[model samples]
Target: MTNAIEFIHVKKEYQEQDVIEDLNLSIRKGELFVLVGESGSGKTTTLKMINRLEKLTDGEIFVNGKDSQAVSDRKLRKDIGYVLQQIALFPTMTVAQNISVIPEMKKMPKSEIKKLTYELLSKVGLKPEDYWKRMPNELSGGEQQRIGILRAVIAQPSIILMDEPFSALDPLSRKQLQDLVLNIHEKFDTTIVFVTHDMNEALKLGDRIAIMSKGKVLQVATPEQIAQNPANDFVRDFFKASLVKNIYDVYIGRVGMVQGYITEKPNQKSMLVDSQETMRAVFKILSKYEYVAVQEGKEILGYLSRQQVISYLSEHEKD
Candidate 1:
């Protein structure tokens, strides 16, 4: 399948310093591609380039096989949705009005826009009746964040760009929004390019990750591949820190932790857990059951015992 977004030898320089250098990437249709890096790594700049919010200094970017530069800026932007770190809601506008901004700008029918606004609110886990008339100040930080997402998705854009959209929320709210985004992605099948400095968040949400540093992509691979086989010393140290913290984010809820234990019986005694849940949560579950089920969303991926959980934790501690 052709990529929904592609960057070829893309470079961005300002005053003789390259913010992004000779970058190449391809994000497949309907896949979540995450970019992770330290501060000043240019992840945000690269994302801006995709939506033409930032002009590329050199090379090319393509969206759905069409040259991005060839498209009219307004039309191109209208085809891509963007959610930024700041929840840029219009304070004077109600939730429904804020969400309808894009569609209204597109000259959509009033009735159609109203219907779509309600649908988008529901999609972002908000009830229309409760949230529609509320202003930004009346909503919680998390609720505002959801409104930001709803505004972006209201247009049914083919691709979405998220720049640390959950970074400003509390941990509990962040987790809720993360799961909400994943659920929406699955239902809508929209290609997403998400940017974060949080390694755990990147691993949990990304289908593939691109690790960047000093304006260059250091590694691009599945979370498992990056964890098990780091491409370089920096990558190795990255996982090392995660391991020391007992946050094996990449492999937290993946299959094959306990071999030959997955069963197919419906209503089987099992524990339900989020893929992004901590290993400590797994241990707590194991404390109660001989074999506790592991899960990624609603799908079961076999079971592990108390002994296995303890043993795995011990071994990782040694590392």
Candidate 2:
């Protein structure tokens, strides 16, 4: 239950303009927390402050319960792993060399470093024999990213900072890397702070997501809560932008409010449908169940009774 990172009254100014103002947030240890927003929203800036990539003009940031300012950047970064969208591997280094950078820097025994490097490469589905000596350009985009992630995690840092790490890859590669990240978190129980502009990506990967705009956080909640009960108009529209454009032009999330569906605490036995599912899909589940739970990813948003769906359909049919 301890916080891995905390921002207190944080502020960052650039050219006399407030890039981040009065920010306060905390990320729990071993949790996969996400920061989501569009460009210039300060989500990226907020992430950088944790590792001191962007220095805060005012206030404090605590990493692992200690004042971040108290630690030298070199030492702090050594304990924290970082992954980036650009996959900034050393073009001159081999894959094994890149993955073993941290351990080597720490003066770990050469044999130990090689053992760990090969073990991690295999963990990510790369063959040690084939990839050990490959240069950055020898790998494909996705392969390069896999190596980038390996480099970050090779040292087994408890906290990892990911800045749009998968954003530059193709859709298939992105999904694969996302799954890899989820698997890594489960396997290591590491505290991860992931930043991305894609809402769908956030919902799929975040245990809790914080939405930001104009250097301010708009809402912070589970993906399900944000989907069903957005904190404001901006939040609502942000969630909406990720939904499928329904043929009826009625947003599924809006149907519960416009019609009548009992919002209840998530029940373990309820039939489930994603909030992004089409109306036809909801009807199929409703045909067999009295009520179906609406969810986004693994989080339950609310419930929609069969009656609620029928009533809305009949009303639309009449029109």
Candidate 3:
């Protein structure tokens, strides 16, 4: 697949410190690429540079095969949709009006823009009659966020940039929005660059993840690869903090859900958990059955309940 975005020897500096240095990365067309790291790691900064929101201090960035530096900033931004942590919706405008803002600016026909706005709202899981005339304050955080995304997608941008778009929501709300984003990706196949500090979010959403520190990309790989083989001690220690043991064993393997066996259907609910995944994930699975099947490639094994998992942890704890 052709690269939708590429950073070649990209460098960014601020005053006395470098925010990103010699970063080389490529996001394939229609893939969700996540950038993850501790605060101040330059992940967000790197994202902004793609749309010319942040000027590069050094190096080259190409979007759809054209150098970002050479493209008109306004045109480049128009072709990319951006959503941030705080959803800044217009208080006075109705949902339809808000979503139609960009298209209106481009002088699209009012009737066509309204049609597009309604379509986008529906795509984002909102009913047109209920939400069209409602003010931003009338909606919940999640609803407002969906509107923000609807606004972005209505522009029909080929790529989208999201910087912690769900970070401000409650847990349930965040999960709903995350699932919504994934569903949208499946349908639209737009290239997405998602930035977050949450490792679980990165693992769940990224087709490929870029780990950054001190303004540099340390490694870029699939979630499974990063867990199994970290590039260096920093990467290893980072995964360790997440409580991942045998990263390769966990991510690359499939665990059959007990329900699957009973239903005579393939298990799709199983997930790979790093040592860092909350006890909640394991507990959730255990609540339904006593045994879960684990697999790597064609090799399959079974794991027991909390007691068994804990006992396994304890035995390995001594090591």
lDDT of 3 at 235: 80
Q: How much is 37 displaced in model 1, in angstroms?
A: 1.1
Question: Per-candidate RMSD vs. true structure?
Answer: 5.1, 8.8, 7.0
TM-score per prediction, in order, is 0.79, 0.77, 0.77
Q: Clash totals for all models, in order?
A: 0, 0, 6
Of candidate 1, the 10-residue stretch with the lowest lDDT total is: 246-255
Candidate order by decreasing lDDT: 2, 1, 3
For candidate 3, what is the TM-score? 0.77
Tens digits of per-residue lDDT for model 2 on 193-293? Answer: 99998887898899999999999999999999998899999888877664432224343555766775576754435687666555776777777788877
lDDT of 3 at 252: 13
Q: For this target, which candidate reaches the highest TM-score against the unseen true structure?
A: 1
Cα miss at 270, model 1 (Å)? 20
| lDDT value, candidate 1, whole model | 0.83
Using lDDT as the measure, name the better of candidate 1 and candidate 2.
2
